[model samples]
Target: MTRVLVPLLRASCPPGAGGYGGSIELRLPDSEAERLGGVALVRAALRAAARELGWKAETFGWTGTIHGTMVGVTDRRTPPAPFDSVVDADRQRRMRDAVDRVGRPGTPSLPPTDEPSARLPTEEFLTAYAAAQGVVDR
Candidate 1:
C-alpha cells in the first residue's frame, strides 16, 4: 500500500510582510502536484497560504493585507518544525532568494527511508532557509 505523507509548512508574518507557509498536505494520487518538483510544490504551498491569508482577512473584515514567512514544515505523520516564530526582515530576503534559486526542475528527494524527499535544488534552498531561520537540525 502507498504511504500517505502530509507535508505542511508554517508561517509567521505581519501585515504586508511577504513569504509563504508550510504545507500540511501533499494531495497525492489524483493531484498533478505530485508529478511536479519540490519547487512546484513549494509554489503551490505559497499560493495556498496566500489564499488562506486572504480568506482570513475577509473573514475578519480587515482591509489590510498580510504576508508570511515560513516558520517550519510539518508532516502530521512526522514531526513538524521544532521552532515557531516570525522571521526577521533580513532573513526574509535570504528565504526569498533561496526559494527563487530553487527553480530547477526535479522532485525533492525525501531523505532515505521514511524521510521526506525534496528536489535537489529545492532541498538545498530549504536547507539554506532553515539555516537562515537559525535551525540547527531537523
Candidate 2:
C-alpha cells in the first residue's frame, strides 16, 4: 500500500487573530486511487475530516478534485495493476486517441468529454483504501 501525505493550506486570519486550526496529514491507499471507486472513497474521507475539524478543505493538485475547499495529499508514486489493467481495452484506446487528437500542439481543441461511470474496486483495492483511511470495515 502506498501512503500519501496531503498538506492543508490555511487561510490568513488577520494578524494575531487566532483560531483553533492547523494543517493535517491524510494517508490514503495508493492502490485504490488508480481505480475510480478509490477516488470516491478517498474523497469521502476528506469531506468527513473537514467537517469534523470545522475547516473548509479543498483537494487539489496531484490528488485531483476531492472536494471543495479542502487540502489534498499525494505521493509521486503510481501503483501498478488496475491502473495498468485493460479491462475495457477498446474504450481505453478510444479515450487515448481522443486525448492525443486534442493534445496536438497548436491545435485548438474542445474540452475533454466527461464519462459518467462508477468505479468497481477489486477486493484488494477496497481493503487497502479502508485501511489507509483508518476506517473500520465491519
Candidate 3:
C-alpha cells in the first residue's frame, strides 16, 4: 500500500466563487495514507464521503496511476462559511513556509510502483481511505 498526495485546494468555478479556499490545512498521518494504496481509492473514498454531505466530487488532474495524482473538486451547494477564505495572504505564505520546513512528501517513486497492480487491494485501500475521511464503512 502507498500514501496518496492530493492537492490541498483545487475548487471549481462555483466553489471558488463561494470563497472556498485558503482554509486550514490538515495533514493526514502516514499510517492513514498507507492504507489507501493510491489516488484512485483516495478519490473514490473522498467522493463517497462528500456524497454524504450532499456534494459531488469532480476531480481534475487525475494521471490515473499513483504517480499521477489529482485534486478532487467539490460541489458548492452549501453557502459559504463565515470562516471560509478568512485566511490572509501573508498567513497563507507562512503556512506554506511551515509546511516546507516540517512537512514531507510521500515516499518518492518512479513511473510505476513496486506492486504489480501499482496499488494495494481495494478492501485495504478503501478501509484506510474511509478512515482518513472519518467515514466509517457501513
Candidate 4:
C-alpha cells in the first residue's frame, strides 16, 4: 500500500484560513483493495496513515472517498478521484490510462483516450462511495 497526502485548496478562502485540511490517499494493488471491501479498506488505510504520521487513528479526523479500488481520506472533506477532478481533459485521460496500466507489466500500455465511455468505475468504488456517504452501514 502507498500513502499520498494532497493539500486542499480553495479560491474563496483566505491563504491561511482554510484550516489545516488535506486528503490522504491509500493506494494498493487492485485485487487486494477489492478483497478488503470499502469500509474495511478505509479503516485499514486510516490506521496505516495514523501510524505513518505518528498520530492515533481515533483522533486523526479524516473523511474518506473511494474511486475504483483507491481510497482517499481527507482532514475536512472527501476529495474527488484524481481522474474526475482534474480540469484538463488530456490530463484526466492520462491519469485514467495510468491507473488502468497498473500491475500489468507485460501487456502493452494503451495510449490515453478521450472517450467518456472509457471511464471505468468498479463495484468496489460504488460500495466504498456509498459507505462514505452513509447510505450503507460499514
Candidate 5:
C-alpha cells in the first residue's frame, strides 16, 4: 500500500485564504519529514488543495491503502503551538525526571492544555476534512 502525506491546517481559515502561491507553508514533524521526504510533503499540500475543491483522491495519481501522516500548514501570521506528544507514559515520566535532574524548575514536560491540538488520526482526519469541505455535517 502506498502512503501519502496528508497536510491540514492547524486552524481553520476563511475560503480562498489557503489558495495557491499565497504564502501558506506546510510542515511535517522532523521524524515524519525524515521518514516521508520533502517531495511527499509538497505532494500532500497539492493533494489537499485539489481535494478541497471536491476532486476525487484517485485523480491525484495514486491508489492503495492510504496511510495519511498529519502535518500542519503555517499561515505565516502566527507561530504554531507546540506539537502533541505520542510518547508513552513511561517515556514521559522519564523525560520529566530528566528535566528535574537538570534543575529546570517550572518547565512543563507535557503538552499545554491552553490550546487543543489539530493533529488527528487518519479516520478522524478524513471525517474532519469531509466536514470542512462541506461534504458532510458533523
Candidate 6:
C-alpha cells in the first residue's frame, strides 16, 4: 500500500476567520486496504505519528484513486479565510520557512506550495472517465 503524510495548516484569513489547506494524496494498490485493515487504520496510524510529534491530524474521504491524510498542528484561535481567497505566495513562503525551522533536521527541501487558483481535479476526473470508457486499464 502507498502511504503519504501531508502537512496542514490554518490559512491566513482576515480578523475572526480562518481556513484549512495544504494536503497531499497517497496512491496505493487497492488490495493494500485489505491488508491494512481499511483506510481507518491507516488514518489512525498517521494521527498517532503526528501526535507523537505534537501535531494534530485529521482525515478526509478520498475523491480519487489517491487517498489523502492531513496532519499538522491546528490553530483554533485563528479564523479561516473566506471562500474567495485563501493564501498568496508571500504567505506560502512564510509558512514553508516556518515549517523548515520547526521540522526535523535534514528534511528534504519542499517544492513550491502555492495554489494559484481554486481548481478541482479535472484531470483526474478525466482520467477516470477515460478508464470508464474502456480506453485503458484502471
Using Cα atoms with residue i matched to residue i, what is each candidate's TM-score against the true structure? 0.20, 0.27, 0.30, 0.25, 0.26, 0.32
Residue clash pairs of candidate 6: 17-79, 17-80, 18-79, 18-80, 18-81, 19-80, 19-81
Across residues 1-138, which tens digit of lDDT does each residue of candidate 4 receive? 214221111211122332223233444455545655544655565556545543323422223334334544434332235422433343345466666766356776666556422122223343455565566653
What's the distance in Å from true for residue 43, model 4?
2.9
Number of the candidate with higher TM-score, 2 or 5? 2
Worst 10 residues of 1 by lDDT: 55-64
Model 6 over residues 1-138: C-alpha lDDT tens digits? Answer: 111222222122222323333332334344644344555665565455444433334544332254422212232222134522443443466566768655657776556446432122223422444455565854
Query: Candidate 5 — which pairs collide?
Result: none
**How high a TM-score does candidate 3 get?**
0.30
Model 1: per-residue lDDT, tens digit, 1-138? Answer: 001111223223322333322222222222222333333444444445435443221111111123122211322121224322232443465455555455435745333443233343244444554565577873
Candidate 1 structure lDDT? 0.33
Q: What is the lDDT of candidate 4?
A: 0.40
lDDT of each: 0.33, 0.39, 0.40, 0.40, 0.37, 0.38
Error of 5 at 47 (Å): 6.9
Q: What is the C-alpha RMSD of each candidate to the true structure, in Å?
A: 16.2, 16.7, 12.1, 14.7, 13.4, 15.8
lDDT by residue for model 2 over 1-138, one digit each (tens)? 223212121221112223222233333335435443455555655555444444555544234435222224222222235432332343355567667657868877666456421121223334555677787871
Which pairs, if any, clash in model 4? none
lDDT of 3 at 59: 43
Give me the overall lDDT of model 6: 0.38
Clashes of 5: 0
Q: Which stretches of candidate 1 lie over 4 Å from their true place?
A: 1-11, 15-36, 55-138
